[model samples]
Target chain A: MPPRSAPDRLLAVLDAFDHDHPALTLTDISRRAGLPLTTAHRLVGALTAWGALERDPSGVYHVGLRLWEVSALAPRGLALRQAALPFLEDLYEATHENVQLAVRDGAEVVYIEWISGRSAVGVRIRVGARWPLHATGVGLALLAHTDPEFQAAYCTGPLPAFTAHTVTDPALLRRMLAEVRRTGCAVSVRQITDDALSVAAPVRGAGGAVAAAVSVVVPADGIQVPALIPAVRLAARGISRRLGWRPA
Target chain B: MPPRSAPDRLLAVLDAFDHDHPALTLTDISRRAGLPLTTAHRLVGALTAWGALERDPSGVYHVGLRLWEVSALAPRGLALRQAALPFLEDLYEATHENVQLAVRDGAEVVYIEWISGRSAVGVRIRVGARWPLHATGVGLALLAHTDPEFQAAYCTGPLPAFTAHTVTDPALLRRMLAEVRRTGCAVSVRQITDDALSVAAPVRGAGGAVAAAVSVVVPADGIQVPALIPAVRLAARGISRRLGWRPA
Candidate 1:
């Protein structure tokens, strides 16, 4: 392979950080980025000077506030979350459950915002968490609205199951996606966790396309799935409206 | 001046984006970054491929989701806000007021989280928004907890008044900060806006140093400063404990 360019080398230093290894030493970054120690030191110094990475007193490096400030401009990230927060808050108030807003990223759903309700059922979801498209309500809602060819390919792809209830059969998952499109919502029962059920609805963007999904998770046992559908749809519609979506 | 390094050239491409210029064309970026069009194109291409920036259908560029995902690891940003959210939600639920969490950056406060109450008084604040240290309650709370020498220097700096009620005199500002330290809360009455009053308390980290501030903003008229004091302080302490702080 050819030698990495300067831009690639710099980006590699940033790529050394992730959800799991958020903090790292210079040696860790050098090893992770596959760069020489001297090169890593120079690049890290530049990144720290530019405020993309910060070094703590102990010499450990982590992502910095300036990066967060810049990333806040991502329309599919914090910008979307900021627009949807008030409606999410309203939904949280109405249901007192774990509310989430997520967008489709490849074959997975990336949760951008999450509001945990006091006394709500415990769900393994947080901001920046990811779940497969066939394994959660928000994922299904987003996948259901994608291009037919993309959806078809995803349906035929390997569907990892978190719980036995997670949909694994391509035909059954396709049918569920059909139902989601027809009913304007998706109900994922014990898909991610054994005891949680999520009801979700698609949020549209200004161009009449599904841009994101909003959902609420509750205990699977004694869940009022029917009662949740409308509330979830309303919040989705509220966020869609805020995003400049208009219904015909 | 020394010639710019490769990393500086790349960071300048990112620095072209801000709250005001979230979206930009290649030419805009080239101009803003003070780079030649060809150089900007190459850097932008690298950034896009690395998922730090994204190009829209219209050929405009934006901060991307990958950057947001990486920035989520910022301890001073989302990590702090995540640890503080439950307390902020409880505060919002208890008072139905606009809740804010901010950290001091130099002589300014950067709001990392904000939950706007539907019926709460409108305050000109948003996530990632900044205000001077003396013009907001969270700013004052954070400022009062800094090293005495730093605090003294900041107090003596120019205090630009927002509203007529903003503290402009260095001596008065010093007294106010002392009171904040003594009472463990900062109450700024109509400092930011004529109709808004904010009560803030500092949150400590594991090392017993103030890391952030949590505040609730209400209308200036008919405000109960005393009633809000304990509630705000409680929330701050709760977040501090969650962050591994222990009472001395």
Candidate 2:
């Protein structure tokens, strides 16, 4: 293949970082990005100078505050989270559980915001983390609102299962999607982690398109599903309204 | 001047979008970045394809979710906010007011997280916004903890005043900084806005250095400074502890 574009090379350097590797040395970046050490050095210098990356006093590189400042402009990132925060806070208050706001990207759901009370059930979700669109409550809520053709194609997959309750069969997933749409909310019971359950609802955007999903995660064994549905849906609707969504 | 670097030109495209200019067309970017239309188009295309920039149906460009995902790795940004969210939540729950987490970036404090109750006093602040290090309560808290030399230089400044109550005199600012250190908190009354007051405290990191600051914003009228100071300081201490800080 031809040489990578300048943008690709720069992005590859950034792609080297993740939740597990937020900090890296120059050599690690070079190796992970598959760039020559010299090339990595030059690109890292450029990035550091541009304030896209920061080099700590210890010489480790980190994604910089400037980059975060720019990224805060992302409509689906800080902007969306900002619009949804009050409602998310309300949901947290009502349920006293973990609350999340996520948007679907391809076949995955990327969490944009998360809030868990001090005594809330412990879950591994973090902002910017991605999970398959068929596994989580937010995923199910978002997936259930997609175009039927796209939904059908998505369900025909080799779905990965995290727990015994995860719906791996396409047929069952399709039926569940239909149910999610019919009921106006999705309930994911021990689908991701066996100890947790999530109740979610779709959020609409300015044009009334399903733009995101909101959910509450709680302990699986003693969840009050009946009580949670309205609270979750109310928060989703509140966020949707904040985003200029209006029901027809 | 030497020819602009490829990465710089690409970054220029991104820099064209700011708070007031979140959406731009190709021509708009070209003019803002001082590049020819063709060059701007090429860079915009590369950025869009790489998922750094997004082009909407209306042909306007926006910062994309992918960039937000990458920026979430910034230790001073989302990562720090995530770590402090629990404490911030508690502070909000107790006060039912605006809570903020900020870190000093150069001479400014960049707000990384914010939580305001729906009926909270309307203080103008959003995530990723910045303010000078001597005006806001969070800024004063962060500024008070920096090295003496840095603090001295910052205090010798061209401090901008937002309201009549803003402490613009260098000597007065110095005295305030000393007081912040002595009291373990900073209180600003109508510093940025006429009707707002803020109380802030520094949050120490694992190395026992002040890493970030947390604050509560409330209405200036009928304010109880003594009552709020301890709550704000407690939230800051709680976050600092969660970050592995211990009393020296």
Candidate 3:
């Protein structure tokens, strides 16, 4: 492959920021973006002037509001989350659990909205956090509804395990995907953390394709998983309906 | 001014998108960003490849999830919203009104979070939406706490009026700001919409500087504005405490 162009290098500077690194100094940006300090300084100045990055009083760089304003237009981010929030709130009100709305991106699920319930089980998930497609309820719901050809390719991957119950084997993962499709819902039990279980259902867009997923996470011990399935399914369907989807 | 650099031109391609123009074709982007078609195409290609922009099957471009994921780190956007969400939820439950959290950006207030209350007054505001600093409750709360010099300059001119009640006169606006500071809250009545009224309070950061404002909008007619003040102030204080602010 050829070397990255100037725009590509500039974008890499942004990509250097993530859940783990929300704020950084110019030196950190240079090292993480693999650009020279002088180049990074010049680029950071440009971004700050354009309102894409903010330099705080302490001289730490942070993602800025202008970028957030632009990113709010992302259909799978704030737009999708906006359409799904009312339904998620309903689900939260109904179950008083950790309600989440997520969309699949590549081999991972990115949570776009999270509504914590006052009496809900404790879960570590937050907005913009990503988890493996095979280890999350929303991920399974999304992956199950995707094309079978893509699913087959994904199943052959080196699936990482988080706990003893996480399905890592390709064949077992395939069975799990099939089950998710058959049941029209997905239950991820202690896949992410041993104390949590999530029930999720696929949300469809106007074209009848899966656009997102809604889920409810609860404590694993003595949880009534079956009781939560209908609520999650209802929330997902409500959001899908709001998105202009109709059951075929 | 000297000609904008190549980096500025590239950033202008992104600046072309806003709440009104979330989706654009190549021609539209080229015209809006003030770039020739070929230059726009090259920059768009780079942005598309870097996942900052995504092209739809119909050839329209949109801000992409990768950009959204990065922008989610914005301290004044998703991070602050996430921190204040529980308090916002509590406020919503307490009043069943249109609850919002906003931060000032130059002469405008950008709403970072909004919770639509069932059976409450209708509000035009949404998450990531902006309004002038003199035209809304949260805006006034934020402007009231800003530096005196900045506030004087902002109050001087170009205070656009949205409704007849909007405080457009600089002297009156200054007096209103003083009242907001004295009362520790702001009330905007029939400013944005003739039928709506909002009660807002300032939220302080760890350094005891006002960082954001919380508000609740309700129907203006036959409403007890005094009754809503305490609830909005309590929510603001709760969020401020969460941000590590302690009253002297």
Candidate 1's docking class is high
Residue B188 error, candidate 2, Å:
1.9
Clashes of each: 0, 0, 0
Lowest summed lDDT across 10 adjacent residues in model 1 chain B is found at B218-227
Measured with C-alpha atoms, the lDDT of residue A25 in candidate 3 is: 99
lDDT, candidate 2, at A159: 94
Candidate 2: tens digits of C-alpha lDDT, residues A1-248: 45998888888999999989999999999999999999999999989998999998999999999999999999989999989988998898788899999999889999999887778888879888999999999999999999989898999977999999998999999999999999999999898899999999999999999999999999999749899999999999999999998888
The residue ranges of model 1 lying beyond 4 angstroms of the native Cα positions read: none
* TM-score quality measure for candidate 1: 0.95
What is model 1's C-alpha RMSD? Answer: 1.8
B1-248 in candidate 2: lDDT tens per residue?
Answer: 46899888888888998888988999999999989999998888888887889888999999999999999999888888888888888898899989999999889999998888878899878787889999899999999999999999998878998999988899999999999999999998899999999999999999989999999998999547789988999999999998999887
Two-chain complex of model 1, DockQ on C-alpha atoms against the true structure: 0.84
Q: Which stretches of candidate 3 lie over 4 Å from their true place?
A: none
lDDT of 3 by residue, B35-139 (tens): 989999999999998878999899999999889888989998888988998899889888888899999999999999898866988888988888999999999
- The collision pairs in model 2 are none
* Candidate 2 whole-model C-alpha lDDT, 0 to 1: 0.91
Clashing pairs in 3: none
Which whole-number lDDT from 0 to 100 does residue B142 have in model 2?
96
